[model samples]
Target: MKVEGGCHCGLVRFEAEVADGPVEVLACGCSICAMTGFQHVIVPQSAFRIVEGRRETTTYRFGSGSARHIFCTQCGVKSFLTPRGRPDAMSLNLRCLDEGHGLDVTNVAVDQV
Candidate 1:
């Protein structure tokens, strides 16, 4: 399925392709993930494309500095990130989508902390 999403202020928009079946998401217990309520829908980089406001996004990294946490500079909404577990993939924030788009989400709890 093709999904569309963006940051809160509409400063960052993107499109991604997910599997046609159920979309499995990850709910991490790490500090950032917990604080931001990030539900990760991991998809390959090739499956995600930035449609607008690429320069309006800010990239943040911490600790291991492997994952590239990208957020909107205007609204501070983290729409997606480069995940450490899947270096070549992007972890899209399920909440950032249009009302979550009614995806069949299965949240897998991860003790990343």
Candidate 2:
């Protein structure tokens, strides 16, 4: 399914293609993810595209520094990231997606910490 999303301040926008069926929502117990309330909806990087506000995006990394966490500099919203384990994948934040995407959200625990 095709989906659209962006930052709170409208400084960023993106489009992505998710699985055809139910979207898998992974909830991580990591400190940063938990504190920020980030819900992971993983999709391959080839299926994701940034449509606007590219310049307003910033990258953050820590620990292994494998994943590149991309956030909106203006609104401080972490909309997506290049996942550590799957460098070829982009993990989108379900909370940032526009409504009516027909995603059947499921909570799956991840030991990211």
Which predicted model would earn the best TM-score? 2
Model 2, range 22-110, lDDT digits (tens) per residue? 76798978778999989999998999999999999999999899989898998899998888888989999999998887888878889
lDDT of 2 at 91: 91
Model 2, global lDDT: 0.89
Positional deviation of residue 36's Cα in model 2 after best superposition, in angstroms: 0.5
For residues 49-103, could you state the per-residue lDDT of candidate 1 as single tens digits?
Answer: 9999999989999989988899899999999999877888999999998765767
TM-score for each candidate, following the candidate numbering: 0.94, 0.95
Cα lDDT computed for each candidate against the true fold: 0.89, 0.89
Against the true structure, candidate 1 has what lDDT?
Answer: 0.89
Model 1 misplacement above 4 A: none
